[model samples]
Target: MNLEEKLKQLPNDAGVYQYFDKDGHLLYIGKAKVLKNRVKSYFKFTPKLLPADKLSPRIYKMITEVESLEWIVVPNEHDALILENSLIKQLKPKYNILLRDDKTYPYIYINLNEDFPRLEITRKVLKEKNIKYFGPYSIGARDMLDSIYEIVPLVQKKSCIKGKEACLFHQINKCHAPCEGKITKEDYAKLVDEALGFIYNKNKLVTKLNSKMEEYSADFRFEEAMKLRDRIKSIKKSQIQTGMDLATNENLDLFAIKAINNKAVLVRMFFRDGKLASSNHNYIKQNKDDINIDINEAYSRAIVNYYDNELPLLPSEILIADEIEEKRDIEEFIKQKFSKSISILNPKRGKKKEIIQVAHNNCDELLRLQNTSSETSLYEDLKLLFNLEKTPNRFECFDNSHMMGQATVGAMVTWEEKFVKSDFRHYNLEAKDEYAQMRETLMRRVESFEKNPAPDMWVIDGGETLLKLARDIRDSCGVNLDIVAIAKEKLDFKAHRAKGSAKDIIFYERAGEILKLELLPSDKRLQFIQRLRDEAHRFAITFHKKQKRKEDTQISLLQIKGIGEAKVKKLLLYFGTFDNIKNANLKELKEILNEKDAMLLLNYFKNLEG
Candidate 1:
């Protein structure tokens, strides 16, 4: 299939398309909500030819063995990105620049369970657990690490080799040497409050620090007072001002829009509990309609769509990308949605504008970062592609399994961020055939979810047919969820046989047994489906096989007449055999089985056992 032939079949609507190589490997994955519009832009209409870059050679290779085309039609461009990443990982195409690390960032934690919670760094944070973590902070920043170190001594924590004999730090009068028992455990624990107060509540810490300094000076402890003063000065100098000093009731999110080259970038700054929490930047490749729309209209559409899906944890205040003409209406809308008065700001000057400027600067930095390098953040791209309210942190995949028509089962595998949580479930599929198996699998899945639903997306392991099947089950069970199927890619390049039967072709009658899903001479969809389906099948088969084997062994021994449960169990355990009674002579049977039962067993074996 050449470009002309492929172009003729491509759709005009906005969606995503993928390219595969001859080995049936995905080579390039991309999204263009407008199918024809995006594809046409790739080819030059001018008489003069253009030079190709790094992506050019890769795409050229992908087109070479292009035997088939596949596409997914979604609501918009953002949804396209979400779909793109889902496919990219599902297919792991050879050419797309993939993000490698999926590790969670380490955080600084204080265990609340201890009388004196120790200050240590950790990676995980849980609300149910009795501990508090300060950050998912960067491990590489030297200054940040130094700041954490500095707080240790100022909080009066002992540094004297467990605070034993006077160390250099104690000699320098900077350490309290609590480890040497110079300070009592209770006093040291009190110091923990100061350290936590500093890291978690910097403003309050500064105020408390100044008060402590003044009190020390008044008591004629000039040396101690001076040390306190110096520490306060250092903290002030190191702190980077993230705009705003709002009250505790106000948590704000500010969004700013910047567009260039037919793409729009949105910058978001988050303020939680009256302080800057975190920030993010997103880029959206625009269609012609978006390009023609003014900034305000685009902003309105984007914000409304964003909130509709995400309902971002609305704070008391918000900052807008552009002033919506329906500000009153938006306020009323938010009030109805959140039951709180939300103040939307378009800061023209002062600290508010400064905060907005800071957000804009970060956006520009991110844009430069992307332009200069091929690397892209998966979180940003996924959010843009899926039009997801937020980046998917948790996802669950479902697949059904059966052997022809027996021992059917379903399985749910979960991926939090990127790591699999294998303990979730291996369901026993109770329904028959492909459709019923899927239905039963999803019904059980939704039932679990009805009690506790906690996934951003539920991925199915079949194509369009199974995708719809999963949804229908969810509907019947009154469970609402977003789902998609990762089907086998059709193979159109394999050679024809003597009878003209193509070796690579795969067919589906919408909903039928997945007997040959990927078990054919060569089917692209087969590879994709088998990975997920086989896993589900393996889990199901393991469960059923264990049960079958247990039952079979038990029934085999039960056939012995007059043996009774006790004698039959003993003979099996003593001989470690299932056919021991049938083979044993009368004397050997008498020793293992009961004396009277042994004769009956011998008679039964002689009479009927084979």
Candidate 2:
């Protein structure tokens, strides 16, 4: 059907509508209570189809390009909201504001199932029933865990208990020798409770650290004092000091969005027991010409996309900076999904308004800082240099690391304003040659495009051959992705690996021709590409070293007369590292394996040393 006829057939029931251009590319998606009114409001008949007079410049431009319309009728607005989010994520329409921040924050957790559990940090939700999780901290989780270990006498390491004997940690008094039954389980529980108090009360933890710092300084332990001082600063920095406590012990999640020049920043703050616990911010880059986009839609998508995850805790209420048009729909969706009654409020006055103002100010400051950063100019330079279709917001770089074709591995690192560590991936490749390894890595990545969509560009760490290989792999997968490769200057067909003195060349395909450009070492664009290539190299090498180490350990231990895979694994688990196992006496080995097997292992190690 034609666009006009399809518009006329729109149903009155709630549903999602999609706009497409002449080339059949999705332009936008929207959910509405009445598909007919909402879809018709974008255009006026007036004898001929035209954009409505009250439409924003952004939407007006979109309407001018929209050549077709489609709608899916749903049972109600709640389903419409859900379907809209799902389609936008899967399709990634042009006009939609996609939140690129998929990072999982760290949480300090304790598995209570163990008799003497050690505190550890995790980015994912564990499947343990008897567990307690602390904050989903944006920063300072490691520092906090370290400080707890420094202050309390708990199990110092995971392998400590399995050792079934005291180690250096117990001798140094960092642990209570729980492995040797020097400390009772009840006493260890007290230490665990003390550590929990530090996680629960940030202020108390800071105060205690300060006292310890003072004590250390007075005893001439300046180094120890300085370390404690740094930890205290880190823990304090994690807490958002809003300066305006609700004083009512109310819990809420505050969301504030600010946009300017097609750049939007969403600031989210979590308040628990009337105190600001943690906060996070995300940057949303809109279409190039979409400066005056709708803020209400941005707010709606942000709230829905964030809460879509299985959160560890849900606040009693949600506060937003603006009164979005789809507030009621979001609340209903949340109620249905979470089975919890919560209010989403946009306050006009009082403490709630003040809190929202704080978040808004944060968003504004973040946007301002982003505008002034060198990354903006760097992106513009890169786009012009490469003659790219648009400023590349997201980049995925690939590199291969191996030792004479042994322990081959490939790594892909992501960059969006910063190194997106969560999206970085490493692959163990069986392909021995460099070209084959690069091809395999790119192929595997392209195959998973449905789950993890392709980035705007691919940066490879090789010369023209590997670059073309990447392009061929991507094309074979029927995906149109930009690719560039950086390689070190070659001397007599050998790559110069020296840093600072070696020059680098960048190659990109333009108009079906391979173009090689050699920029000065001082060029910011060159430095940017170098950073990405180096990170990919570092990641791949790290993984390769780990694989190589594991292989070496397996081969060496399996050669021992009474040791097999199971016994080797037990020894490694107890000692944590191969070096530790080598230094371990017969007693430590016996703790993990049979006495005879332990003797055999000890003799093998001793003979090697001799």
Candidate 3:
């Protein structure tokens, strides 16, 4: 449809909308308080407001598919919020902040049913259970058990400390000493109720406590009033001094986005009840754009995409670093989605705005941690470490095995990136030779690659002879490829020889010295090659064992009486296959056997042979 025609048809209402490519693939999913107004704004805006100026070329790919737009109308802003979250997850729109990590933060769960009411940290949110959870906090050094040390006494609950009078907390009138039976079950239940209220409704609890302190002081209960004052101070001290203050709602989500030279860091600070749950900062790696674009639009896309995929527990409010163009729409959408009217505030002064500034400071610290590491990308390291002109995107390794040149077999393994392709080949030699077996295996590998060209590097698990054979096969098959070899010390296969450790294996390329790769012990490329070599060795040995078992069984049958010399040779020649002898009937065998020896041979065949 034409831009004007589409805009005229759109309804001015709250809803979720999907933007699709020419091929009908969903590019982005978003919600707006006024569906008609929001959808129309895109086409109406000048070239300066185009997404092409801000997002990278990778993102621009989605813009070509703007052939059609679809919308799902909802009753209110919050309904739009819920629908947007559900649709984005189902469709997994391309132009969105993908949830990179699949992990949940831990929350401290208090089992209200338990007599002692133990507190434990859990990853699951078991909503069906009658339990209270607080703080999806950091998996930091301070264990959740440590919370019990202060929490148990703070609530004046029963403890296991026995055969003693009231503890100092109770003597000082801070605790009711339920362990010593000084407090009744009814009174203790009241304390439990207060604790639960404080956990889930921190701001309200603190407000009530403050009021109680004021009333007690007015009644001249100085000692009682002083205790409440200290308790309030203690709770405040536990929180991160982010300088963020909310009037009645302590549970809030604060987001701060900073853009410097087109790069951005998004800081999300989560507050639970009244305590600091955790703060997470994510940096967007965007190349500096040629056209200077509005930073606010970039920030808006970042936040929307993040929340769309994550859909973390909706907070009572969101504090942004700056004003966004779709501020009203985002606020209404969030409030409806969370089933609570949440404020989207840009605080001018006081604790709320300070919280955003604190989030910004935390952003600086996050950048330091991410960029300081000297570790190289795994693929790049592999390419340099192996000294290959091209990266080892598809690498092949080979190994040979035999029991004293008997039942010889060769195996070829392939590595693509960091993964070993297990479905490769293990071939029987047919000829009783190691060099010939290596030649046959290499020939097969080259031929296979020729038929199905997976143009890449090769890693042979032998020295000069094997490497040369592999190259010859590549030439014969007319398959040009890069190749390397890892040869173990000759003594590695000797009988009664000590087993070789990692240090014993020498990594040899076609052109370089066969040195211990251990010199570059820290190199990721060498480590990857070592794993491939180990895998090739394992495959070759396993195939060789099966070949040996079959050959040994056939050779063992040659020793029986009347199954000797010419007769045995005749039987072997007539059977043509070893498996036939295993299944041959007595009558069928009698025709091949001499008459006098037929009976003896039948008895031998019926009985188990060595």
Candidate 4:
């Protein structure tokens, strides 16, 4: 629709709005409390009250080029704030501030789906069902893990169920030997809960440690008492300090922002027990037209995103360096998600204000250093653009090839940053159906995980049907690998005719929800995936042809003079039935096959296509 028509129909509620250029390229994305009022303000202003010169030159250019407008209405401003962030990342509009980070901290994760769960260290935390993740402790993540292991007596090896005998760890009391039935699952579960409680609540941890120290003294074990005493003191001293005057028992998250030369930097200082526990900073690349945007809008957008998608952790209080546009909206969202009360404040005085300044100062140094590395940034872009958990450094592309349900074969090509020919493999299939071929192929490929584990991701050369098979294989094998599917826009299978060119359909996922992306031919990601898929196709087709060549000898018709295996097979197929060819007279067969071939084929009971 035209701009005027779209504007007249704009909703009067909070929502995210988009401005598109004549070419249908997204120019800008924004969140507004009242979509109608906010959108109208852009073009409705007269030169007298609101001077045209007051607007940023970049905005003026964007406004005139805007041929169409679209909006998605949400329940409240917080929903608009969230929708806007997701769209900005997905579309990467020309006129918006892009805030992202290349580095992610390590977190201790527990996968509760296993019969005996395993605790592992991971830098990436995904929102999957039945999995718990803790800590982004920057400097001492290893030490934190070690501390928990010592207190919990959990499994220290890859598989506790495998080591039937009490290993060294169990002998030294580092593990409770669940495999040997020395500890019940119920008892072991309590120890795991206690370790998790210590990580989440410090007061309870200190109290429990203190009680242990007293018990050791009453038992007359002075050496153990001294050790327990030192542990208690160390726990108390490990408390973080933020140089703030507020009470040290409450938890808070302090946010600060700074913008310069149209680029912006945001800093978030996490406070637990009213002390700085961890901090994060990200620089935002702003579009030229973004000069007209206010810092308050940025803060509002940042607040919604940081709490909702970026971190799983939460605090009772959230302090901002400046007032944001929709404080009530943000508070409401936080309350609903956490199911508890939350206070969002803009401090005017006291220590809360001082911490804001400290965060702001950190942004200045960040801008000076410009420490964003290029290699890491590329992977971040790939992850966001492709919707992946890890940077796909190694990926495999799979494809199946067949000719008339004969000589069916499946091929998988490995790519480590680029093609790795030595790691490529082909599977001979027994299934005649195409979809069945895919399932069997994937089952065999994943079975190899016993000897060689799966790649970072698998790129299948088909649609969601093939992707589902890949996912099933991964779950059954207990392998952790991401799946991507690439298919053609059209499927044409005319023999001896060139396959028409079509755009690739890329299937990606975010938090297990699959999304389809169609990029232009010139897009780099599309080209890269095409190369991987094409290699797999080439490998499969080449093997299928080789299989057909080998089978040609079994017919024994290829040894005949002036007659080939291909011509003989085609003549047999043209007939309604292959058995008719064996009984046909020379005169009857010459009409379909050549005279010399008719003599040769009449002598041989041709066994092939009907």
Q: How many pairs of residues collide in each model?
A: 21, 0, 7, 0
- RMSDs, each prediction? 19.3, 4.9, 20.4, 19.1
- The digit string of per-residue lDDT tens for model 2 on 163-249 reads 878999988889998778898999889999999888867888888889989999999999999999989888887866788779887
Q: What tens-digit string does per-residue lDDT give for candidate 1 at 1-610?
A: 6545676788877788866544444455667758887665544434532222332443544454555456778877656655664454334344443222223434456666754455765554444457765533322222233444444563234233443365666666656665565766678677777676656655665677688778889999999788777767655543235646655645676777775554456666656556664454455433222222235534543444334322324566778756776555456545655577877778788666778787777667666765564222443444444344334334577766555555566767765433354335776666787777777777776665412343545667656667667656654543223454655454463333345453322223222232232245444334433444445455656776765554555574576555567766788777776565466777887677567877776666566534
Q: TM-score winner among the candidates? A: 2
TM-score of each model, in listed order: 0.38, 0.82, 0.43, 0.49
Could you give candidate 4's per-residue lDDT for residues 1-610 as a string of tens digits? 5677787898889999988877665778988989999887778545322214444665666687788888898998867866776666545466554444323456667877755565677865456778876655544445445556656788887866687788888878888887888888788788778777776665566676677667878899889778766666555544343455456656777778887765577887767655555566666654333454567667766776666543555677889888876788778877776677788998888787787777777877776665454433544566668765345556788999988987899999997545766578999999998789989899887666533445667899888777877777766654446788988764454222235565678876665667788888887677877888899999999999988765654455566666676776776676655456555779988887778778776665444333
Total clashes in model 2, counting residue pairs 3 or more apart in sequence or in different chains: 0
lDDT measured at residue 472 in model 1 versus the true structure, 0 to 100: 62
> Model 1 TM-score?
0.38
For residues 208-230, what per-residue lDDT tens digits would candidate 3 score against the true structure? Answer: 76887788899999997887777
Give the Cα-based TM-score of candidate 4 against the true structure: 0.49
Candidate 2, residue 58: lDDT: 85
Order the numbered candidates by TM-score, best leading: 2, 4, 3, 1
The candidate, 1 or 2, that scores higher on TM-score is 2
